[model samples]
Target: MSNIVSKSSILILGGSYFIGRKIAEVFEEYGYSVSILNRGTKPLTSLNIEQITCDRNDTECMKKALNDRRFDCVVDVSFKDSSWVENLCDTLDFETVKSFVFISTSAVYDIENLKIPFKENDKLAENKYWTSYGLEKINAEKYYTDYFASMNTRLIILRPPYIYGENNYAKRESLIFKHICESNPIIIPKTNPKLQFIYTDDLAKIINHLFKNNASGTFNVGNKKSMTARDWVNACAKVVDKKVKIIECDYKSLNRNVRDFFPFFDYDNVLDVRKINSIFNEETPIETGLSNAYKWFLDNKSQIAFKENIEKNICEILAKSN
Candidate 1:
């Protein structure tokens, strides 16, 4: 694919989060005029991208930002609710905007039959009940897909599965990281389930490729490989040269932190990336990306601020005990 978007002005919502910041960084690296719209709470000192302060959920604020100025493309990372999606499209519903990229999730797919190589056209559970978060995203995708179907604007939907990397909020990768560093027995669900992980940088690169290629479709982005939860933990321990015990506890015996979503651990939810491969040639491998990510955590473990978070979480747990 030719570099169609050589130097275009880009807007990123939720520009301060893990994946969001990575996307901003990659775009800025490519010489794109990047403007980040967020709450401005998460301070980033090194980024050369322009920062815009606005709560995207507020329709008036969203309209004010793009009132006169128009961007070549807008990547919405914080667009969660249906209202935000509608108002966002209304604000940027223009002829000047070239494309709109939505950072969706693979959670929108049916989890019942999640086998390998889950294609875009694969059958999904249409009548499935979406949770508050999932429903909003489902509706948001429809709004964008249908709205941009007639317009000249290209809509790119990226469904990333289990996004993880250095500085991730989900803390999914932290499970393996913390397990490898410490010697205490790590409690894992007894059931072994296969899941996918996408390093933030890798995901950002794929999104960049789509923008450059003017690709418009739904693409499931993640590491080309999938591994079971047990395998990942064992691999991490091996890499760090740590000897630890994996206590396999049933769902009933799990702690509050472990029991909340323990039922889903047995569900296989590996997202297929064939559509992404067909659209873009480059894809990040799991082993290389995870190795780099593990090294990053080991090098910067002290500066990661997991201690403060742990203290707060412990307090929450204690209060619940009371």
Candidate 2:
């Protein structure tokens, strides 16, 4: 007997955190029956969605959990390497799965040789800066595209840069928020590199739109505009109505990991989203998104695990400058 599944039924892999969580929430709000597969470490806040607790790394365990189950669409936000995608394809009944969406990264682009406003078809190179993370994602993308094509299944790949908004565990916005709240100087690299960001909510909407329209292709997803590092810090400050002191220092003088000291480095990582914009109209402005992020930070500051020691490093830089 064939398995019966609703047209709107969707399954999200790694829906317990960040982008995946938002995707699940958006699908649920749109009245889609949502199911999530993740290791039971993080408890899903949403009670309505079906939860499958299993580690994707464990092939046998994952296969057993999703053996008979099937869905119209599968969104994979957890795949880190090509092996994981291979494992999933090997285990799942592809005939029952119509669409497979993979959340990839803009890091897959060759950062050193990349031009401004990178397009979807731009050549991808090994990410020397981020090292293995980007290379692995690129491999995963290749595997998914090839595997799904061989199976004659629909595949959608989304590469987004610097996804931000509420529930962002990454120190992207929160680092600035912590400084702004405490009335500290926002230290930045002297180069004042341009950066691009995509709101998590906006990304979620894009995923939903693509799934509904049955869009299949590799697309670069990001806001239409780009902002400088200083502008990003100022925007965060503006959201909280805080006066910020901007201190620009030489990148080499900081003597710390760029990722640790700066939210974004002195590189133009902007993505060309004309293709996606042609289909999805709603783009969240940085101001609005930063404001919303600040609101969430205020309500959940205590819970946030502040990972970077940006403040202490800034103080040390100041002491040396004196």
Residue 236 local lDDT, model 2? 90
**Top-scoring candidate (TM-score):** 2
In angstroms, give how far residue 52 of model 1 lies from its true place: 0.6
Q: How accurate is candidate 1 locally (lDDT)?
A: 0.71
Off by over 4 Å in 2: 1-7
What tens-digit string does per-residue lDDT give for candidate 2 at 120-178?
A: 89888786676898899889998888787777568999999899998887767988899
Per-candidate Cα lDDT values, in order, are: 0.71, 0.84
Per-residue lDDT of candidate 1, residues 1-322 (tens digit) = 3433556998888889688898888888777888988889988645578888988778899889878877888898988688888887788646777778998877676656556556666654432334456556777888889988898988988887777666666555555567457664555566666777777887778877777777788888877788877777776676567776665545444244443422234556687787787776575666666676787777766666544554444345434434
Per-residue lDDT of 271 in model 2: 92
Clashing pairs in 2: none
